[model samples]
Target: MRCQTCGDATSPEHHECQRCYTPLGQPAVTPGLPTYRVRGIGLAANVAVGATAVLYLVVALYPLIGMVMARRAMANDDPDLLVSALIISAVVALIMTVAQLTAAVLVIIWTWRARKNTDAFPGAEPAFGPGWAIAGWLVPFANFVVPARVVAGVARDSLWRRATPPLVAVWWCSWLVFSIGERLATRADDRAYEKLAETPFDDAGYQAYVDHYQDALLRNTVPALGCVIAAVTLILLIQRISAAQEARIAHATPQWPTAPIWPAQVWPAAQPASGVQSAPGAQSASGVPGVQPAAAAQPLSEVPGAAPAS
Candidate 1:
């Protein structure tokens, strides 16, 4: 094996170089800087988004439940059932609104984390988290287009910079379109309800209200589907980037050998005495007492009647 510090051949069992004596696997001389726990933040954000989205599902679907209850109330002429359903439906809508806002907040955090994590990567850009811009979706008039464009721009950045995949672009774009459609459908349903309220004494307009309610229900599904697709894409992109980075780091680092053996020079064992006298300088400097030698410590091969050492 070779010593990493001195770049010289070394025995496998030694931690220090034989020539320079420098310590070979000591920690980095300069302490490594701490990095943001980007993976953990992303995981938390994903969890929050998932939970909020589930709450949104319940809230968003409440109106349909309300519609069903309202129809039952109308057919049976039960004012109590009608009032109860209306209140429940209204509360659920309010909850859904809150969940959507919360999800938007989480998405912003996710975007910021993504940018921060990518900062140290080779060829990284100067973009901040997209969460700052996605907040525009919560705005009334601006929500119609700005949010979608912001997502598209981020997605584009991800692809061009190799920050994320092309599928992310598609997913965010679909989400933006669906979000706008859902808002419009919701407004239409609200307006229909208002119109129905104004003609409270007439039962003839109930069908129109039901139709608008169904439209909102169907329109909301688009955004839900888009969210599901986006979530899946995000998971895949994160895994790929993370794995690539890990492999690169591992490959760049040096590895040490694990064996305990050494390769020092080897010498043959001395032969036993042949009851013959040795010539001058026949024995080694740190002489073995019982060993016989050749004439003047001649090589073992030339020694007479000195069978090779067992």
Candidate 2:
């Protein structure tokens, strides 16, 4: 039913809306988990994503700086300064990686809970279930498709409608672009690292390879830009979806069906109910067996005070 106060859909089992806290009625059914909890989780996840994304921007700039500094080094620049900067960048990158992983986990949790609340909503019929939240992110080739689909579904459901989630699409595209760029940069850097270890810096070929390494580092800026966009977009999208769920919850009424009531069986009592008795051959309302109805009767001739039959 639609919430009378806000016109948002909700289950009758809920005493109040998970979003607006608007009272619907007496508990009629078991409602889905609370929306406030999902909101809290989303907020925390956003903080993590936002902070990590900012640091990522720093990480991205370091490579560009490194590439430039390498050129200076080849021109008889201060190698010690370059070495110190790289060491510090590496340490920062390690910290960012750890933080990013933690944030990603929190985001998954938020998605799962959001999907659950949507499913519980009065008119909701989401396309995906909770498991998709994790599976979409972890699957190999399918990861690209599933994660977007799952996120889209949650956002769409939050609106309590079937329209495409435009923000979701935008955020996803940014994320995809960022992922590809980061991968390419990392792969190139790894190759360079292995080659450098094999061939000493003083080798004749090392000078030529340095140019190629600089180019690889320069290439990373594009993806790093994408990462910043994706991070900002992601945080906004999360907040928007949470608000949508709350609005939907506010207008909704409990959709749960009324529980069935069963008749109670009264046990046989020592005395007839209401000090009254049933007439002869009447069926007892209590439905007990082996109990005869109470009534007054004349004594039989077999008894000491018996009255003879007329």
Candidate 3:
């Protein structure tokens, strides 16, 4: 028989799956609860996240490109090309932001559905309810840890009695690192740009502005790299959880027998052999020979010591 949780083949004699340790023939916690399928949404979230990561890499390289542009503008005495480059960078940044938002929405939806599915699995015990899947990401200071817990809970419950994938920790850590680094980088860039705008148009001022911009770009590379690692790990984690849930659903489904194991048969009551017959004097009113019915009792007055009837 195949283990429901992990889809591994196991001996029918065993009480649990050797690969994942899930109990054999375990019944669902709620017998008739519905389960939501997350495989399709997971795939879409993976694609969106992959695109966001690629965009982050491109954005990280923007600083180096900006520095080259600055140098070329100074040499050729032309600012128009530099302005165009800045506009292109802004456009790319906008696109990256949209991709990030799309990815976030898709992932949250998938998480919510996955959490709901745990009710149909026997050993699943989610730490939070389905609502937390979305609310965890919205809470201010708690967002960092709550969202991680929500995902971790889903993974644990989905693969009940099995070790959760390590990718969950890796992805959460990298995501947190990227979030913090990106914020810091954005603040630094804003300060540098404000100072650059205030500086008088002179040789020293231009050089200072270029240096500041290049430094900001270099700092962004850290978050960009983190984003890539988080995205890849998240994709793998989603695949693992989705497959486990699918296997569990298949196992929990009831399989009806196509035919009865022993079909019932009926026979007519037994009869005497072909030539048999009852003798002429054997039959009587009671259907037996040499037997007499009991006589009715005599009246009570007939007894010597009996009192007369009232």
**Top candidate, metric TM-score:** 3
Instruction: Look at candidate 3 and tell me the lDDT of residue 102.
Output: 99
Output the worst ten-in-a-row residue range by lDDT, candidate 3: 290-299
TM-score of each: 0.55, 0.65, 0.74
Clashing residue pairs for model 1: 108-131
lDDT of 1 by residue, 1-310 (tens): 6643335777757765555343455321112422233455556556666665666577556668767865665666555665676678777768767766765666666555544433333333444344536455566876655644544444433333433446656655766655665677678767766665433333444444455567667767766666666556655554444443344334334578888876553332555345445444454443644334342345454567767755
Tens-digit lDDT string for candidate 3 (72-190)? 66666566656766788899989999999999999999989888888666656678888998999998988989888888877887765455557789999999989999989888887
* Lowest lDDT 10-residue stretch of candidate 1: 26-35
Tens-digit lDDT track of model 2 for 7-124: 5687867876554344574222126545544778889999999888988887776766665655566565445545654588789889889889989999999888887776565444
Candidate ranking under lDDT, highest first, comes to: 3, 2, 1
TM-score preference between candidates 1 and 2, better one: 2
Q: Enumerate clash totals for all models, in the order shown.
A: 1, 12, 0
